[model samples]
Target: MWIFGYGSLIWKVDFPFEEKILGFVKGFDRRFYQYSTDHRGTPENPGRTVTIIPAKEDSRVYGIAYKIRDSDIEDVVSHLDFREKDGYERKSVMFYPISSDQKPFEITIYIANQDNINYAGYADLKDIAKQVVKSVGPSGPNIDYVFNLADAMRTLFPSVKDNHLFELERNVSALLNESSIRKST
Candidate 1:
């Protein structure tokens, strides 16, 4: 079974799977539209989604491909289903290998249905930072996931610079400070 990761999964792999290749998917871009209620639950429930938008010119997203045991596919799918909720459906994606030596691979990607889901467009560093700082999900605060993704992006692709992530960190810090002051008052 093949697994494609574009966000937090790129850095944090709690499950076991063989890493296949680092790759890029063209014609689509990533955003934080998916609410992470499970990972960072709001006052209520857990949820998440991947909002795909038109890929920007000269912009390519870096992600990882994994080959998992066939038996594990069901479990992963179930877990993803729970995370994504009713609006997302699993579909095939063409992933171009990042390495000069490797060929492109076709894998599955979870895409959100625009009719029911919110799309957070390609967020700039400041926007993303602000979102990360202010958002909370069922599992925890959203900023933790953002920081991890930013770190992973830097570690995996040295050339990639995410000012939005940096801005997110700074903004979140300020928000946290304000929250503390409010609580104290």
Candidate 2:
């Protein structure tokens, strides 16, 4: 069974997996809509997805593809279904490899509800900052999601650099600092 990781699962896979390969899916993009109850939750209720949409651009989303045992696929799918909620759908995607020698693979992708989507396009640093700061899911703040993505990207594909998330994080941190100062005043 093949599993795709575009967010926290990229860095934090508690389960055992066989192999991980770098892959990308075109047209669709990644966002921090899924929340984390494990990291920051009130105990009673946890982990949820925030309403966020991908940017309207011709870009590739980098993620890891894991080959798991067929027996374990059920467990993994169950866990993912719980995390993604009922609205999200799992669709198969063709993952293109970054290396010329490597072959592409097909994997499942979790897509959000497009009928009512929340577009998170950053017009400037401030817009990106606001999106990061305000975005929260069943899990936690969207910042954690970005940090996880950054960590995974560094570990898995050190040579490949994607700054869309990092730039947003920087903008959010700056905005957070400004907000704190304003609050103090």
Model 1, 44-146: lDDT tens digits are 5433334555566656667888877887888887887776674566788788888998888788877766665443345455555555666676546677776
Give the count of colliding residue pairs in each prediction: 17, 11
List ranges where model 1 is wrong by over 4 Å.
43-50, 56-58, 118-128, 162-170, 173-185
Q: Candidate 2: worst 10 consecutive residues by lDDT?
A: 42-51
- Model 1: how far residue 146 lies from native, Å: 1.0
TM-score, per-candidate, Cα-based: 0.76, 0.71
Best by lDDT: 1
Off by over 4 Å in 2: 32-58, 116-128, 134-138, 159-163, 179-185
RMSD of each: 3.6, 4.6
TM for candidate 2 is 0.71
